[model samples]
Target: MAGNSDPLSPRAKLAVTAGKAVAAASRAAGRGSGSVIGGRVALKLDPDLLARLAQNLDCVLVSATNGKTTTTRLIAEALRAAGPVVSNALGANMPAGITSALAGGSESKFGVIEVDEKYLAGVARDTDPKCIALLNLSRDQLDRAAETRMLAENWREGLAGSKAVIVANADDPLVVWAASSSPNVIWVAAGQMWKDDAWSCPSCGGVMQRPGDDWFCGECGFRRPTPSWALSGDHVLDPHGSAWPIHLQLPGRANKANAASSAAVAAVFGVPPQVALERMYQVQAVAGRYDVVQFEGRDLRLLLAKNPAGWLETFSLIDPPPTPVILSVNARGADGTDTSWLWDVDYTRLTGHPICVVGDRKLDLAVRLEVANQQFQVCENLDQAVQLCPPGRIEVIANYTAFQDLRRRVGN
Candidate 1:
């Protein structure tokens, strides 16, 4: 219950010190980055540490089923143009990890935090961010996280009391329903490509209606709001009728939408849209998501996609046909033990590409790819798959834990 500007209680100060020590020890032990474990230790000692540390900083929280990490990085980098900014840039997004990131950047003038979908409400309550970016919502980690609509309703209810200006996606029905009733909201037509989870209205439980550029409930008349900012083809048009070209180093239309919402969030803190985006032109990757690591004359590019919606977006980012893409999957706790979601992905999109599968759940992927009438080779690991084909740019796509394995192997 203490603020950063206010004198910290002796107990709280001790907890912060202990957390840093543990994080340092974790690095020395070579266990991991120690962000999560360090914060866990701090939370056990003082549950109010996040609130105390984040109280005085102007924070921006970005939450979604995908793109949270990259968008957070963009917003934080953009804010660097205005002043000093700190963020959970490595994707340690929960409360404990959030605390750890803020712990080290006490002198930062701004805070940009990425929040997991279910944890957004609590983080917003503590940080009371100046602006909150609500991107699209889709079925992700259904076995471990809440159901799609349930998560949206929770967001709707939890955000009712928030004073932060909400910058929400107008194209996503779930995000629209959640942020609609808020007193302050800036709508951006950031797209939602996978409509499987959004066909039903969150408010009325009716089939959604899409008559051209707009969506409304077939039964209840809850319609999509007009966006103040929209991603029009390759350009992002702001409220003043000014259009900025979207020439980002990050690939895909999904990230273009991220750039739109990010510029909107940054503008809330007095940074111009073009100024913010110009600063982000240097970012080519985020936490190794779109990293290129070349070895043995094989140009290997790593791409991470955890769910059906994510896979759909990732397919657009991979190189052209016969590029020899290695598909990997895992059913670890981090990736949700149930691999049933694999059925929803249309693997046939990789028809012309030479596909090689690997990971703990490679068998599941093989079956799914088979049923889709697509040809794929099941392999043991990245090297085995790469050896089978003549590769220039080898595309590697994996889920959460599996992606971490690939990252470690490449020394990323």
Candidate 2:
């Protein structure tokens, strides 16, 4: 009984270490811990963390290849409007990280977490969430995740239960097929949310046909419907090209999906659709994700692009390219370690403007830019890249490592 302590003690321990471990895990990621192989050692060292989550009344877990952080933040904010809500806002989606956030927080009506796909099943088993949101599956960190199909298989097996409601991205064939058999499930679609590419039938492996601007699986005919609460318009409407006339707060099309997905889950919980949208737009962008920082005399937009799909979406949102772009790329072992994914990104959009590429893979980025037919200025350092660019409002597209570097230099 000495170590058994209280039933909730494990949860409390997880909460206490959630913030600290994220900080440490982030720092020590590539150093060891075997993060490169999708095998996480952090959760193993902390056994009671999962048990602690099982004690919560209502818990919501968000998992996907993209938009997890932004969408999760939006969900937390929506819940906060009604009352206090606790979350792991620092982009730590792993089991221990989620447990830490929950255990650390005081009592509340609901628990919202943005979980990582690699750890989703484990998190779900331990947390016993009232609901779980599977955003979308995509090819990401091939070195660690292996492939999207493999991860999907793991998700299907792990999510077999009736304790939670499954909210999924209808636009994604993989997610649609994965959740089709789930009894307690609700599906939401972006419905022309942006230029999406993940449309196909997971069941038949045929090209998922697009009914309208949106997509569906033709072979299986398992087309997910758009959530009744999705935002639709003649156009996304960007009055201000450079500075954002309407001020989305969260830049790009991907953020739109994040916001919409967040809204969908909140709505399912009885939060009004209008209320969810209002809270989503009103919420400030999560720090370092797609935050716009005002530096000395210049304004800098910080957009994080950790994978091919993410980078493509970020590129789409740039509108008229920056007079000069500051691009930062890094493939630290902690962040998938392998930079080969860059090869999959269609960097050709940069051909219209000159880019100042920075980060650990500066040279490779430059090579990519050139191959994409983009004109760029290669800088050995991120700070220097930011420096060489014109002052007033610089657009910075950075990955995980580059984001860290930009934060250090910009005092973020």
Q: Who wins the TM-score comparison?
A: 1
Residue pairs with colliding backbones in model 1 are: none
lDDT of 1 by residue, 43-112 (tens): 8999988888887689999999999999999899889998899899999999999999998887788999
* Candidate 2 accuracy as TM-score: 0.83
Compared with the true structure, what per-residue lDDT tens digits does model 2 show for residues 48-145? 65555446546788888878888788888778767668787877667655655565555566778888888888887877777888877777776787
Best by lDDT: 1
Q: Residue 36 of candidate 1: its Cα lDDT?
A: 93
Number of clashes in every candidate structure?
A: 0, 5
List the candidate 2 regions with Cα displacement exceeding 4 Å.
1-46, 191-200, 214-220, 225-227, 234-248
Instruction: Note the Cα lDDT for every prediction shown.
Output: 0.89, 0.67
